[model samples]
Target: MGSLALKDLTEKCTTKYKKISVTKDIILLKNYCHEIANKSLQILEVNLNNVESFKNISEATLALTILINRKRVGDVQYLKLNNYTLPQAVNEEHIILTESERALSKNFKRVVTIGKGSKAVPILIFSGCDKLKIF
Candidate 1:
């Protein structure tokens, strides 16, 4: 998935669930699944044999979300899904506002832009928590 899509998904999750804390790594994994889905869509046009890959990706994404919720409540120490160990955190930065994303929030206020030239796409802005906000 592109950075913009990842950012949008991350924002969506964080904003929608105000009580739950979402980490950067989880967002990255979600984006990876999204990319897989995108690839699967492309592959579907060529061959139906790739359908199983799409199913697996969907299952993995669901499992990851479940594990995250478990971890959030201090019920798990490590995230292990599909026989793979996921790091609690990633060193890479996940939040970087693009020009278009920045335009969605003017003067630190969330605004929805619509229609025509120079209009910003609507986006949710998360603040207060450093982990939630894209810098």
Candidate 2:
């Protein structure tokens, strides 16, 4: 399931149960936690008007907690699911990287640069797409 969907499910579960019940499968729990974090980040990226700012620090800590708790869950392969961060792996790709970039720039009012030393990359916001000339 997608991160947002998983997070919605997790939120519902947490609300319904009030307290989370742990199972023997630590991998599953860690996966859920990681997805939750990704979902939170997605919400921020979308820039929904009614949504409050998502807290990254707390979410990161929560994910770490789950990882620590699931020590015996084998080598859990955690994957981050988000449009700009990681592209969909399947042949039928849902997200187009360039289009996603444009959409995110319009919606979130920021560019999502994917690379090392991205902070060092100079940001020159322009009036039109063609007007953008990165040196």
Largest TM-score belongs to which candidate? 1
Off by over 4 Å in 1: 1-22, 64-135
Candidate 2 per-residue lDDT over residues 86-124, each given as its tens digit: 422433232445776656545321222323433322122
> Ten-residue segment with the worst summed lDDT in candidate 2?
126-135
**Could you give the C-alpha RMSD of every candidate to the true structure, in order shown?**
21.0, 18.7
The count of residue-pair clashes in candidate 2 stands at 0
Residues 41-83, model 1: lDDT tens digits: 5665578677676575455444443443332321221222321
Task: Compute the lDDT for candidate 1.
Answer: 0.44
- TM-score of each model, in listed order: 0.28, 0.26
